[model samples]
Target: MITRLAGPAMHRPKLILVLVGIAFLICGAIGSMATGRLTNGGFVAADSESARVAEILERDYGMSGMQLVFTVESDGGAQAPASAARGREIAERLRGDERIDKIVSPWTDPAMGSMLTSGDGKIGLIIATVLGGENDAPAHAAELADELTGARDGVTVHAGGQAMVWSETGTQTQKDLALAEAIALPLTFLLLMWFLRSAVAAAIPFITGVAAIAGTSAVLYLLTFAVDLSVFALNITTAIGLALAIDYSLLIIGRYREEIANGRDKRRALELAMQRGGRAVAFSGLTVGIALVGMSFFPMDFLRSLAYAGLAVVLMSIVLTLTLVPALLTLLGDRINRKPLREAKPVEQSLLYRIARVVQRRPAVCALPVLLLLVLLGSPIVGVKLGLPDERVLPTSLESRQVGDLLRDRFSGNGLGTVQIIVAAPARDGAVPDLRDYQAALSEVADVRSVTGPAGIFSGGELRAPAGPGTTAADSAYVAVATGLDPYSEAGQRQLDALHAVPEPGATVLFGGFAQQTADSAANIAQGFPYAVVWIAVVTFLLLFLLTGSVVLPLKALVLNVLSLSATFGALVWIFQDGHLGGLGTAATGYTIATIPVLLFCVAFGLSMDYEVFLLARFTEEWEQSDKTRQANDDAVALGIARSGRIVTAAALLMAVIFLGISASGVTMNRMLGLGLALAVLMDATLVRMILVPAFMRLLGTANWWAPARSRGFLEKVALRE
Candidate 1:
């Protein structure tokens, strides 16, 4: 198959390369525009109960929640007439803005005025409801912030809220994407040059990386028309695209160099290299692509968008590896080796080879300790706490984060955030038992600060005031439950759980707000996780079995990959969640983002499989060549590591470097992702691939090639071998 394609390509390499360049230029330009089309916010499923309640509240009650906040600190005191004047001025100014739906401040509603004032009586808030969707909030907020903040007649004003958070998140993500590329690209080019030892050869991978990224970006742009693409997908496009392109190119070009040095003519060498290297790249791309497809099983657009971006990257890398890289190799010919430096002396008993031999000699001795160590590393996840993404996910220095901190620490009522409990009842019920029981039950729950419903304001199981004037739905009413804890914290989750467990008579209760949204997000992920796992497991097993023609090897590979990820998870929990590495410029959030584990699993598992296929392909080749003996098994293990270990190590290091650059992002989730996946790839390549693989294979011996005799025909039909 490869020979047929390459034979024609060699005849017109220049034309093919030129067209490839043109396509890249066009696709890249289109893809660059994708950033503008991308929207943020997929932390919770839109169809969830929390989402439904929020929708009802907004559409029916005209309460779209606090989209932006203006903070005023009085040079005097918050209760002073002068301070009230400034707060009122800011509120009136916001009301005058056509974009704002409503502006609520201590100066506007005397009943809730004190609640909006700080404890020290120096700060007051004006919470504004902006017109637009979450994606539009940032632009509106930016404009409002510029006008509302700085100096407002003798008072200082600062603006913040979810709208500002999303807008700033989008902005920071774009900057960080550029920063990661800036850090990774030059280093990657140097690494490629050092490894290939030819500037012309090194340029091949860069070209491939750029084309893959641009093509992926262009695909993402097209996807924006069909589905809501997350701005986060841009980061995925650059990181995964560049890393995989370079990896596939390294494998292909390395093989081409070896075949040429072995005295094959250019065309024959190219055909042979394509047949072997191209096949491996195809399988690797399939494995990575399958993992991404598994992530798409989740209902959240966040994970789904990643799948879209990831699949584009994988497909682009495969196409370029098969077509563009091969064309470049044909065009360059021995120029790939122009002014070639002398090769390093071959070490028959290198460290990797020696380690493999040692493992093969005493399989249990090597495998058990490593397995134990990985499990130990992953142990901290036992204490994992999941939460919704909040302002804390932003950099600590961000204005939004600072405002959130002040609100949490200094204010009351909505400052702590509210959980809206929707109580549905027919108007014929006349707001009797349904509203009364829900309010009373919720008020009786532990940590319940207050509950305001159609019946009244209930606190500590007693009525504080009669129900305030507001439009009552013909069929439903919303009771706002206030808590003293941040709604994305453990205390808030516990409070929310208690609220849900409360018995409501004659009403259908639906909870909404930050706490409820966090719960709903967790529930959705839990429900979707099994489907993703099943998809990944079944597809990976089938793919690996087809490649190796051995059920035992594929299952073994799966187990080892899982083990490697355990260590990665362990490190993430210990360092990021537990703050063990807080001294290293790490921003430790006591709880992990709920979606991060899922993202890490998809990315890390795919990368693990990449290295797995790379190593096992070489092992299968060696096994096929050797005579079927115990001694031959030993030789295959030794020789496979010798031939492939360098590529695996170098690729792992380079990919890790790229991911480390991603870790440098200001976004906490991206930082966690970068660190976790980098750790997993390094562990998989060194500890699992090098050590555990040889140990397990040695222990299994000839059994590594075993499959049921009934499967022989199927294996012969599908098995990939040299």
Candidate 2:
């Protein structure tokens, strides 16, 4: 199979490469077109608690629950020349702009009045939220910034709210993803070359990984039209794609080379590589892909994107494993083992022998240190802070970020996107009262800073703030309210629930905002994520167990896998979120990505397992012929490490470096995730795989073969048994 394809490709390599290139371009063009229409929008009523409560009672309830906040503040206490007057002018101009469908602020123009409030009571803020699918933000922002900034005016006028946040954050997120996308394969290539020590061999794995990314990226691009593609999706796809591609290509390439060295004909070698190595690659990718898809249960759009991205990358990896890799191997023929492939290095008296000697000698001495280290590192997780990602992620020089800092200390800043408590008209049994009790109750909440409509009617009913003629105490009859709190903090979440707890007979209560959203986001993750981990483990176990015919070996693989992931998680805490050693490269402002843990766990698991499969599969094979299971195991582990460990470690190190490269980015979320995942892979390659795996395996003894009797018997019957 490989010889036929390679013969024809080698005859005309340029033609085949060009055809592939053309297809890639066409796919990209189509994907780009599709993504163009798909804009990343802010999750509104989503971030608010009041909106959620209201969503239950009516149609379009979710749409009505979000509050739009727009504000412009003065630079410190310095009085600027005529800026306040310009801000007032901008407001007047917006009152008549056709692009603006609505304005909610304290402006007294009865015609344009919707609650437009003046900042400093001098610098006025305009609030606009899309209720009927209207976005007055772009036009409003353009006019305001142009009028304010264009005049060389020191006073800066900015428009922000759900829409603005979405527009800005989404664009930045794409750039970060693009950086990752561009770098994943090149990094994969360098590692493969350095490890394999053969340009052809190195090129093979990287080519496969790149194809997987490209093909899967096309597929994920298509899925975007149907679902919201989370910015986090690209990270997952690239991570999984690179790992699986490397694994898939590695297996086939190794098998092809092995067949050749065993004196098989070119065609015969290709056939064996396809028949045997291909099977393992298929199952491995499938298991990992299925695990990734499990994230969809979380209900967050971000997690959902990972589901499809994982699935796509897995499929792409498989395609390359099954097709492209065979073509490459057929083309390379005997050249793959450029180092003059040595006969299987004797593993009998190697590291495995030493470990076996440890297990056979003094198990307690070997295992104690290993177990103690895992527990010690896992301890800091007790202090884990699951804070939502913040806009402090933006460079301090950015207007929104600088102002957000001001807001956090002096006012609410971006953290103000919390606590939506609904105040509404009083209701009688089975009937809403003519009076707006919701508006009145809103004023009663101690956490509130401002209030907006229960003024308009939903399918549920109208809400109203407390009654008053002017800006003083008597203001009434609004939807629910707006409040200030540390968004997503313990106090903030409690305040949100308190607003929801208002049990008034006269009016309906609702809570919605950053706190409510964050709480829901956290809950959804907790319930949905265990499945992802389980699915990965179960599938990986089945595949590895079958390939090796050693239930014990899979357990060993799993242990190493877990350790790799845990070590990285701890490092992530120390570097990205804790601000300890944050000045070092795995560094960023002390904020983690909102969905990073999920991505980090999945990506790290896939990567660690990538090395696990490459090294252990060989051992499982050798152990088949050696009746002495311990000797075969020792030799395989030792030889596998000696032969491929350098390459895998190098690849991991390079990948980690690529991740650290992103630390230089202005976006804090990107830096956090980049640094977190980088440190994880680096630690995995050096400590977890090197020190811990061998030490523990040295201690497990034959009971590491703790399979149930029936399964053990089955494994023994199959040649896969070690």
Candidate 3:
């Protein structure tokens, strides 16, 4: 297949380049509009209780919760005549806006005055419900935030809430994406030039990188019409696309250069390089792509969007690597090696070969310390706490975060953390008693400050105010329960659990709020996690077995990949969750983002398998060529590590460069992703790939190539080899 593709490229390199260039240009044009089409919210599971409640609230009750919060600060005091007047003016301004569905302020409704005012009486809260769906709400909130946030008429206002936070997060992500690209691209090129030792050869990877990103973006843009995708998917697509492009390019070019130096003509060299290196690239992409597909087992669109983005990027990288890269090498010919930065060393004399030899001699002695180190590094994962993203995910410099901090610290109650409960009770007079009892019971639960419902505002199992208009409908009623806990914290999750445990006889209850959403999302992920793991494992094992015709090799690769990934997760927990690394400019949030671990597992697993495929391919090739003896197996292991060592190391370093640049992002999630993947790549390349693999292979001997007869026969018929 590779030969057939390279045949035309070798004969007509210009035609291939022209056609690929035109396609990339078209893709770039279509992809330029993708960001606007992407959404900022997908963290909730669609089939979860919170989602059902949200849908009911929107469809049956016309309630979307508080989409925006305004913290109004007055110099005099909250009840001062001037301050009160300003607060009323702000309320009236919001009431007049067509986009606002409802408004609640201390100045407008004195019945709930104390709950909306700060403890010191110097700050007041105004909550507004925006009239729109999830995508439209953020946009509306951004406009409102811009219009109302700032000092005006002797009072200062700061805007925040779900919609505002979503808006700010999207804006910040765009800026961070630009910053990441600025940091990663130039550094990657310099490293590429150093590794490839030719400006022309380095350019090939860059070209392929740009094409992959653009093509993936275009695919995502089209996908948005069919299903909602997260804006954050763009970040992963860019980082992984560029990294894979460079990785595959290095593998192909390295082999082509080795073939050329061995006296093969340019055309024959390209053919052999594509045949050998291209097969590995294809298998590597399939492994990574399958791993990413495991995310679809989860119910959250956030993970699914990432899955789609990753799959698209992998597909683009593979297609271009097989086609455009070979064509470019065909055109460059001998010029690909011009102006060498350094001369190449023989495979047997390379540092990787020497290290493998030492480990092979004393497999147990060399393997134990590395395993212990990885285990020690991975120990911190035991304390990992997962939660959904919130204001803290944004930098403290943002206005929304500042407002959120004020609400959490200065305010008397958690208005933004209000747990909205929908009760499916008939809105007749007969149901009023049951609804009031349910509200009072909720107010008496642990962490509950108050509960306002159709019957009245209840606290400590008693009514504090009369029934309010708009809290009841024909067949449903809305209850807002306020608590002081941070909604995204572990304590807040406990509060949600307590709320769920409360009995509401004769009426069905659905909880909807930021806290409930977080709890549901975590539950959904936990429920699906085992299945996703099984899928990844089963498919990865199958792909590896097909590539190597060995069940033992696949199992070894899976176990080693897990160890490396565990260490990576532990580092992330220590640095991002426990807040040990203060130098990265991001503070520890005490909890990992719920989706981040799942995201990292799929991405890093696929990437780890990527390098695994690279090394194992060479091992299989060498073993196939040798006599069937224990000494020959050891020699094959050494020669395989020696032959593919530089390509793997260079690719890992380049991939690390991309991820490290991602670590420079101001957003904590992006930082965690960047730093975690960077750690995973470096550890896998040096410790796992260099030390553990060679040691284990030595210990396993001829058993490493063992497979059942029937399985071997099946693989022989469908193996992805030249």
Candidate 4:
């Protein structure tokens, strides 16, 4: 099928090339509109307990996760007439905007008390709610923040909150994507030229890359009308599309050059290269697409958008590889080799061949140490903890991050880190629960600095008031538990766990707050993790088996991929989570965001399998051409590595450079993702695919091709490799 398709594409290369250019121009225009439509928030699962509570608050109380806070700092106390008057003036001005639902300031509401005032009396908070909650926050946040950021009547103002943070994060992400590409494209081009040894050949991947990115962006734009797509998806789309484009182009162009050098006619070389390379591209794309599809099983829009973006990008790359790349290759013909830095090495005599021979001679010695090293590196994951994305995900230079730091450090006993306990009245009694007893239980819990409830404010087992204005009860009573520990820390989670265990019988209890939200997000991810693993494992094994016609190789591929991914995860924990990379001048977020590891596992695993498919496709082809003997198996292993290793290594190096450039992002999570992904690609290419794959193949010998006799017909029927 691929050979037939290539014949016409090669014959009418100019027409096909013209069509491709036209498609790019059209899709590029549509794709440019995707960014404005993409959202900045998707980190929360809509069905989780935290989301449920948030929804209730929004629907019933007209409250939302989105806020726009003005921190007005002045020399005089915030309660002084001058400071109070200034704050009210700003609030009153904002109140006239119909898009603003409510504005609260300590100047007008004495009940807010210290919750809105700094201990030193220099800082005061003016909190306002958006009309449409988080759904509409981003649109309003930028304009409101601009209106509120400047000084007013001698009071220095800083604007922040969830809305402000979201807007800034979106802006920073776009900047980072541009900066990453600026750093990556030139370096990638140079590396491609060095590998291909021809400038004309090196530029092909960039064309395919641009086409894939533009096509995928247009698809994402279409998806926006059906589902919310995250702004971060653009980064995923660009990086993965570029990497896959380079990878597929390298495979096809290198194979075409080899066939031409072997004295085949240009037409024959095009046919053979597309037949084999197209199959490999197809199977590799299926593996990646299936892995991305697994992320869609999780309810979080963050992961789901990646699923959509990644799948679209992979498919776009495959189409370009099969269509545009071959069309270009056919047009170039011998001119593709117009420039060469040096004489090309023979396949059996290259550096990769020499390395494979070394590994083949001592399979166990070569494989065991790498396996052990990976296991040792993965040990830190046993202690790994996850937290949801917060203001801390932003660069410290951002005003929102500064405000978050101020709140955490300056307000030790304030409500910023408080856990909200909502206790609904008994359905039979229609009366609020014993608020005093509930408050007592909460106060007695370890790490609970204080508890404010409808009955009173309780601390150290003492009630300071019978009825505190801060605690209001309608159909449900509210209890606020304040703790000194960081809400995302181990101690804080423990305190939250302890709060859940406190006695509050005959009442429907719901826990909500920053800490609880983080915990719930982590739990939601964990809940979907088993299904994601099963989907990837089952899908990849079936796809690899169909491609290779071997159960053993698919299993081996999974193990090698796991080993490589484990090493990447371990590095992530060490450098990003444990803060070890700070000395190396890399950014570190003290905890990994909950979605990152899952994101890494799915993406990195698929990428690992991509190289696995590339290498194994050659291994199976060589084996099928040889006699069914142990010596033939050995020869196949060595020959396959000799043929595919350079391309795999070159692709890995180029991709690693792209990932590292993206790691320069100001957001720590993006940096973590970039660094982890780069590490995974390089390690898989060098340690796993190059070293361990050959060793294990040598050890398995003829058994490497073993499959159930009954499954042979099914495998041959669906076989993706020529």
Cα lDDT, all candidates: 0.82, 0.57, 0.86, 0.82
TM-scores of the candidates in the order shown: 0.96, 0.80, 0.96, 0.94
Better of 2 and 4 by lDDT: 4
How much lDDT does candidate 2 score? Answer: 0.57
Residue 129, candidate 4: C-alpha displacement in angstroms: 2.7
Of candidate 1, the 10-residue stretch with the lowest lDDT total is 338-347
Give the best candidate by lDDT: 3
lDDT of 4 by residue, 123-205 (tens): 88888877655457766877877876777667788877777888888889989998998999899889988988778888888
lDDT of 1 by residue, 1-722 (tens): 55565555667888878988899889978988898888877778889998999898888787774478878887687767877887887788878887788777888977777777888888988888887776676788988787767865577777778888887888889999989989988998898788777788889988888787788888889888978888888886678888899899888887777677667888888888888887788889999999888879888878887887788778878877788888898888888786532354454657888888888878898889998999899898899888778777788677787788788778755554778877777466555354665687789887777889888999888889999866367567878887777788777888887877787667577888888888888887898899998899899999889888788999998888888887798788888778886814655657888888888888889989998898778778878888878778778878888777777787888899899989989988788888888999999988898788889888888898888999999888767665
Error of 1 at 718 (Å): 2.7
lDDT of 3 by residue, 439-541 (tens): 8889998879889988788889999988777787777788989898888888888888888888875777789888988888889889879999999999999
RMSD list, candidates in order: 2.2, 6.0, 2.1, 2.5
Better of 2 and 4 by TM-score: 4
Task: For candidate 3, list the clashing residue pairs, or say none.
Answer: none
